[model samples]
Target chain A: MAAAWHVRGLVLALLLAAVEGRAEPPEEESPWFVPDHAALQLAGSIGLLSAGPGWGFLRDGVDAELLLGWAPPAVAGEDFLTVTLKGQWHPFRPAWRGWTLRPLTVGLLLSYTFGDAYFVGLPDRYPDGYYWFKTALRPALLLGAGAGRPVPALGLRLQGYAELVATDYRLLHFLQSPATAGTGLFSLALGVRVRF
Target chain B: MDGPLRFAVLGDIQLFLDDGADAVEDLRRRDVDFVVQLGDLTEYGSAQEYAWVAELFDRLPVPSFAVLGNHDVLGTGADIYRRTFGPPFLSFQHAGSRFVLFDSNSREYAFPGNVPDLEALGEALAPEPGVDHRFTFSHVPPWNGDFDAALTGPLEQLQAERGVSASFHAHLHQFESEVRRGVPYFVADSLEHRNYLVVAVDGPVVRVERVFY
Candidate 1:
């Protein structure tokens, strides 16, 4: 239990560091490793809330993020911890009424959970091909839109986004029951990203 | 304020959640007093799946109960099960009939020998003046290979000694029943097969029937 809290502490510290950094760094002072943005999200399959550091490239059109997620027992019926890597592409960004809108954003994320019961490969107790999918790692496809505007005082761009996440497990079950899978085919995640 | 005690027992849900939904609808229309799902609620035992299944169960017009199956022990699945359905070995009485639910997926724990915990089950099945009938439910049957082979005879003997009216199980995914030492053992059919078991007890007699949906 102490180990779990220690890991959680480390992740929290990392996210806090990203959030507390300078609003603006001169081109010469900023290194490639410095994150371009920081994000906080809620209600993704990975966790009830997730926070991360994100890198923006290709004229801020493409993004890569590393997130730490946690779901408390109060909401999720059980405690959950996950680390997610996400990649996204925004093909079009339109400015309307001082708000920049990402008309289309396509993304994918792979998340890994921490626990002894979850295994990436079959355990020795089971024979070959006992189970196909890994419970420890989950990959999801994301589709949605976002809009943001410059915050002059903070020297940052604040963006709000919504994503429809279709996890691998949900997709697998979808084949068996489209009617039941119905709206459950996708879970909604909402978040805010702050870019320096 | 009485009639025959009516309850429905469903088999492994696993990937057949749609079928599970349909079964709940059928049970509602049939007017059962309560319902029980034998186990294997999810294939991978993901929290999303557990949450989805909880929603499906809540749709039932009657109270519901569930047992832990082999698949439900994957990852932190067992803990999730406890959080969702309470401790695995549960005993309760409704309408003078006793119901006992326990974990029989010994193989999931690598045959820990006490997976079924016969001593606890014996206590749960102990007769009381008010309790008119006894029924026990678990995932793997005592005779199945997945069950703790060493504990089979003892389990069967215990159930027989207790005069259990019926012992129900699911995991073979098919419906089968036979008399073991004069007591009935019924294996429920999984939702994939489009059928479920309904048990009705009248006074001293218990009747179980398969209803195809």
Candidate 2:
């Protein structure tokens, strides 16, 4: 299972790199004060999806934004709210006329979850005394990198992002049971971002 | 040579410390792609317990993957799991299916959104253009107080939206099957019962049989 995640991580990294490599110098300079714009997004994979809005400020074609997202849970069966702070350097300034790395952005995120512990599918050996589902506090640190290119012809902004989750798993799971301990939970994600 | 893959899912092999040898021997007689240990393979997540479980898994003929359980995280025990197994939450593909293994054991400590790490699960579950089945493995389920309930509904919905074939979890020790938001959640039996879930898949078709050994 570990090997497969590595392969997928590599694919995502390469794709992000390729997209960033398409950047080009800006065609025209916009007033720094205009503060580019903002967008709403919906993203998901497997049985998880998150949607929310972000506000972006543009200066010399560089954009920085803060995002707030929430997921209702799908496969894992939970819900959470996440806040992300990000900065983007779009060298291509919205469009790439030729070969340029376009817009490359990197940022950090933090999230929190609410509700009781349902502890979905544990085996029979784990007794009721062993675990708890309602974790009041949970936080994660994510280092992310992303790139985008605008395809006016297709009426979309094509972008991709890769994020690494850094956090402790046991604390997050908060297993009150004797059966759980030690393990930390973290993740990496690469996905395309489309603006309609 | 193309056939279904067979493997075992063992949950919380704790306290039984001395009873493990028999389970190891039983596994030797089976043909499997690999074995997946659901977590709590140790009593205290101690190096000593980990070493014992490592030896047991080593006895298997096929490779094995494991998720880090809460019990495996106390003191230096968590460090032991990383050194002995690999990552806590992980994802992989075998026999044409995608297996997303992640850590859901929350509350031994706390993070802003660290426990469930929904983003990570989302990434692991994201559609693989060509893969026929998507399966999720974790030590704790959303219902457990140790898990974040807020993330459960979203996770179930995502699995349904993403077309996940099934979700696997251990920590409860009993065997069960339920549909949450239209997704099948299978909880395997513990080693004490000498039973495990054996999953076989061919494209979109999957067969899960309870095996004792």
Candidate 3:
């Protein structure tokens, strides 16, 4: 529990720093390594909470993020550490009353968990082709929409989004046993994205 | 003579939790001595799913045991299985018969071939003075590709030498019964099939009947 709280505090601090950084005079030709945005997410199979730095491209319609996620033993029954690389595309963005609404967003992510318990390859105990799936790596698809408004005074944009996530395991089970496992095909994740 | 010692056997319950629940309810009414479930208890081996299955098992009136399956070993699932169901390899005597449950999902371990732990099986299958019959339970049958190919023959031979009355397995999601190397092997249908097996033991006589609920 303490660990989860610590992560929460860190996320808050990062967000505050990102917002504060936006108020400074823009750097002349900022380095490519500098982050353009940050995100904080709740649930969706990564963990109880996840936060990350993100970059935008393609006219601010395509976004990529690197996230660090943790779930404490108290909430998840075991402590889990996950790092995810996510890519998203928003094809349509409309402006309404000073707000930009992205009605459609499609994304994909691959998350790798850090722990001995999760394996990318079969342990020496088993021969090759024993099990088809890798436990440590998980791939998922996301569909969602978002709405953001520019805060001119702060030189930032605050966006709120909701996503429906379909993980590989969930998709496989849903296809195999639609009658029983269909309802669990998608898990919901809510998040806030801040752009500077 | 308590008539015949009767026990129930169930197969994979993966993604069919509701059906599994119905089967458990049916088993409760059958008055069996105990129940053995072939694994694949959950679709993804998540802790939440383990808790759900454990809760369902808790509702059974008779003692029950679960075998470890391939799906149950995914991502920390092996640890959760150990915590939720105790050791994957276990042995106990009940009603003059010896029951040995072991991990046999060799493919999940990438086929290093020690999954069934033949050495441990040898110890468990060792003859006991008062034991009238011996039965073995595991998730994968020796005939399946998921079972270790190199150990299949040796495993069958060991069971035959040990005089195992019947070897029970689940993983194919179907039912099959055949004799391999002079030992009988039975594969129970998955819970989604709405069927289970009942084995009655009388001294040296054993009878297996498939029950559909």
Best by lDDT: 1
Residue-level lDDT of model 3, residues B84-132, one tens digit each, is 8999999999888999999998877668769789999999999889898
Instruction: Give lDDT tens digits, candidate 1, residues B23-53.
Output: 9888889968888899999888777788888
- Return the top candidate by DockQ: 1
Give me the iRMSD of candidate 1, please: 1.9
Candidate 1 — which residues are off by over 4 angstroms?
Answer: A1-34, B1-4, B130-132, B202-205
For candidate 1, what's the RMSD? 3.1
Which window of ten consecutive residues has the lowest lDDT sum in model 3 chain A? A19-28
Which scores better on TM-score, 1 or 3?
Answer: 1
Candidate 2's residue-wise lDDT over A117-178, tens digit each?
21233334355555442222224444455556678897556666665554333223323322
Predicted complex 3: CAPRI docking category: acceptable
Sort every candidate by DockQ, greatest first: 1, 3, 2
Write one digit per residue (lDDT tens) for candidate 3, span A95-155: 9999999999999999887666667987876667656778889899999999999988987
What DockQ does predicted model 1 obtain? 0.45
What fraction of the true interface does each of the listed models get right, in terms of native contacts kept? 0.55, 0.00, 0.38
Q: B186, model 1: CA deviation in Å?
A: 2.1
